[model samples]
Target: MLYCKDCQLLCEQECPQCGSRSLRKPQANDPVLLGVFEPAIAFGVESILKDNHIPYEKFGNLGAAVTLYVGTAMETYRFFVPYGEYRKSVSLVEELTGPAEPSQEHE
Candidate 1:
């Protein structure tokens, strides 16, 4: 019998609960900002979202040219969720990263 990695539950063919193929993973183009977190908190963020069944997407090293756009270079990472699920994703983000802090308006 083959084992499924996701859902943390073994299955005979596929994960009936999550409907994921045995050994395959899920992917999506979710929108909204979950949070901009460093690598240290990435694991917690991913875990909470996965457990909560929230679809999200992560991006890193967004720069195409290294010297031209130093600001968008590696080290910075982000998480985004679908627009409709923004509220749910926000709650999960808070659970992992604590309450959201106030921000100043961009000029």
Candidate 2:
């Protein structure tokens, strides 16, 4: 597999979505995305990461105002971990919730 620098995604040939040929091996510190999920799964993922002592970052699509009014039901979160810890994190998450789906939107 190759990493697409342009899209920040791991793909075989060109990027599966962008068709870009700019791909290379992923770097150790590159922030590899785990997945995008809703509140329930996102919180669980956070817990797993914390319990395992793996550093991670999460971002929400909606702003504070929107979330405050509409609540988190419509909110979606994106989780990322350094490439070095990616495999371990993926395995841990998969054991409990199966594989998390890759993100479709560009960051």
Candidate 3:
């Protein structure tokens, strides 16, 4: 099984379809599938993934959600893995990036 060190998400030991353990990790060596977000965040994500040898790609410059929604934007980026590696990717991102701060309620 491939493990995402950043997020601690584990990919299945074997691929259901091919039964291969060739799970792809998002790293600088591989092409990352990026989503939209702020430049700082994007750079941070990339750096983390790169540092951990994860493959990824950056997309969008407008914003995070907009890139995911309209499929076009700037200032946002994301890293994508194969379907088999989805869970691991998410976990890694979460671990490396950490969870977002909770919103404070205003009285």
Q: Is 1 or 2 the stronger prediction by lDDT? A: 2
Candidate 1, 16-106: lDDT as tens digits = 5577774533223324445667667777888888998888787664544652566433455667676556668778777777888763111
Top TM-score model: 2
Q: Give the Cα-based TM-score of candidate 3 against the true structure.
A: 0.39
Model 2 over residues 1-82: C-alpha lDDT tens digits?
A: 6887765677788887689888889998787777777899889999999999999989898978999999999999988888
lDDT of 3 by residue, 1-107 (tens): 35343333334564433455656554433322323345566666777667766555554545556657776434344445443444455566567567534431111
Q: Give the TM-score of candidate 1.
A: 0.54
Off by over 4 Å in 1: 1-30, 62-74, 104-107
Arranged by TM-score with the best first, the candidates are: 2, 1, 3
Best by lDDT: 2
Which stretches in model 3 have alpha-carbon errors above 4 Å?
1-35, 62-74, 100-107
lDDT score at residue 54, model 2, on the 0-100 scale: 94
* TM-score of each prediction: 0.54, 0.84, 0.39
- lDDT (Cα atoms) of all candidates against the true structure: 0.59, 0.83, 0.48
